[model samples]
Target chain A: MNTTGSTGLRPILERHESTLLANWITAQKAAPTYRPDLIKENELRDQCRDFLRALMQAVQSGSQNVDGSEWQPVRDLLASISRSRGKQGFSTTATATFIFSLKEPLFQLLQQEYANDPKVLAEQTWATSVLLDRLGLYVTEVYQQTRDSLIQRQQEEMLELSTPVVKLWEGVLALPLIGTLDSARSQTIMENLLQKIVESGSETAIIDITGVPTMDTLTAQHLLKTVAAARLMGADCIISGIRPQIAQTIVHLGVDLSGVTTKASMADAFILALKRTGFAITRPTAGR
Target chain B: MERIPIIRMSKFLLVSIQVDMHDRLALALQEDLTAKINETNARGVLIDISSLELVDSFIGRIIGTIASMARVLDAETVVVGMQPAVAITLVELGMSLPGVRTALTVERGMQILERAIGPTVTEGTDAGPEE
Candidate 1:
């Protein structure tokens, strides 16, 4: 209702809807973000048409701000586009460019329509630029949130897949670790090892850290905690795959590992465990 | 009127705790186990705690105390059949129950006791089939 110097874009957009859409599609196709492999040309045109229609409806409500309740449909449309583009492997800039690319075609149209009035032209062009910038920023924010959640999900999956308990022999269990040992990961590893120990009723467990890259004080403490827990369950834990560097690190950190049994390789630990469990491994005669 | 039973084997006393142990129950079991060890001159004590799904710091300490008591009475204590969750909890509580021997099951615990008691005592039992 506040029509003072309004120069609302809805009338111009409605009058030349076909021309605006044709020019906007051309502009989008020319932009660097346009991907032919991920999206078909028809799908891209449909998205552009939907976006223009939503923008016209929003502008008819007389609020240039994208955050206004009148722009809810437009916001929803951009949010969906951002999410899909993110899933399609579009970079943040590519997703945001979907909105920014409309600037050229609309600005050209605005110049042609308001050429007779320079003052009105300046105001309308500035308003249109600000509006488009806000929309572009909104799309970028949604895309970022989608990417963050995707990363979070991948991290959770990695944590689940990292620790695997393998039963090497009848009474011997091997847990091969493959990543940095954080507190959360340590908790999972401890629980998984303990559960396998109980289920198998194994007297010996070999924790192979060959795939683990670093050894810090906290990681050392977590390892000790896991060993202690396994011991408490009537199972012995043999920390194998101690690279020479890790051995030096452990000693320099002053972690008292004398109470724990450490082996240079899983084979040595397995042999020791077999010996303790009262089993002997002997090679048969060659010609017998 | 509630008491944990202590069964006498050949040279070992079996204490199978199948219920959620409270404070009084744990204390009573400790006293009863020590008295039984002293009375029977038992060589080993096998405690089956596989049924215990939960354990606090107090219960963990009680287990330690029981083992110490049995040791003082000339009986080696073997805690057996501990659930995985209970073991993790005990370790988290920082009470790994040091000086206590542990076995995965009651049969293994009995074997440990049989081995600890030497061949002289087990030679006679070896004549018959073990259940």
Candidate 2:
């Protein structure tokens, strides 16, 4: 090995000397089959490492080329690194380090190879940015789709819970409603109850809500709307199963249920419906 | 007009009012119906108002209160036989009849009661009378 460093190459090697030594050792071990003359190999390795270190520093510091001599060292290094890694049984880490060490010099080579083509540079940048943006957008879209599906499932569950069962009593229709009432659920309840009232041709509809946990203004309003819709179909709506808490909430909220008929419980609502239809429930005589 | 006698069905009482009845008469019918419902220990009371041409807010409030009162007594009240136009008008005016069960016709109201009684009672009755 030449103990005297080239005057112009000394600074470049000093800055990246350790990294260059590691890369050179890796390259030698990777290509154990190659039997290049010892003197030539040593000279080529030192020259290549010095050239690459200088090229990287120049590129990072935005320095101008140091005459046409720069191309010679880069070309030789590329040929050697590519040759060594191409051989069988090259360790991946050694090959990767050698390749990465040549990045700055390779870029310089590419710039010279396409020197007259501004369009190539523009296209390369555009393609890189576009690929990056598209990858980001794909990730975002997948997240949103997952969130939307979860919400849809929740809404479906609410609809199922809000299903109103229409029970026929002597021609009157009683819709027994159980479950908590949210805005979405209440809307579904109204739509279903109204549809049943119209389809069944029933004159009375009793809506029992004893199972509801609590009532808010929105729930109360939804109930009113259901009653109105039922009545519009020429069916009277009776609301039953009001818990004391719910009633107090309605009263405290100052919500006027003045025109809405109410039953205390499901049974009461049904009996009222029976009476309206002229079905008299008489006890069986002691002796037939 | 023939007076429709108040009758009890299952746990409910029914008072059928004539169509085109005066508002005062309807109000009186509601009161009388409620009183009868309370006396019979009926679970519910239905006032057949199919004949009324108009349903105002006052009547609605009274009906609502009666329903509420019946609820306190462990009974319910329903207003039956309301016309479509009347129903629409009341809703348009933001009026809700509180304590009453309103039905399109009296018969439908009865069916509503039967269903409310559930399979246990309905099934018991569904069995043919014993020989």
Candidate 1 residue lDDT tens string, A239-267: 99999999999999999999899999999
On residues A1-288, what C-alpha lDDT tens digit does candidate 2 reach at each position? 111112223343455556556655455545544334422566547655664564454334432232245434443444454444434233443333443433343334334444687676444334333422432333334344445666788879868866855667646776667777776776667667666665667667888888778788978887887777576445667899998888899999998899788877888878888997778676798546
The top-ranked prediction according to lDDT is 1
Candidate 1 lDDT tens digits, B14-99: 89998899999999998898889989988899999999999999999999999988888888889998888898898888988889
Q: Which one is best on TM-score?
A: 1
lDDT tens per residue, model 2, B86-113? 5655765677553355555566566665
Model 2 whole-model lDDT (C-alpha atoms): 0.60
lDDT of 1: 0.87
Best by DockQ: 1
Quantify all predictions' global Cα lDDT against the true fold. Answer: 0.87, 0.60
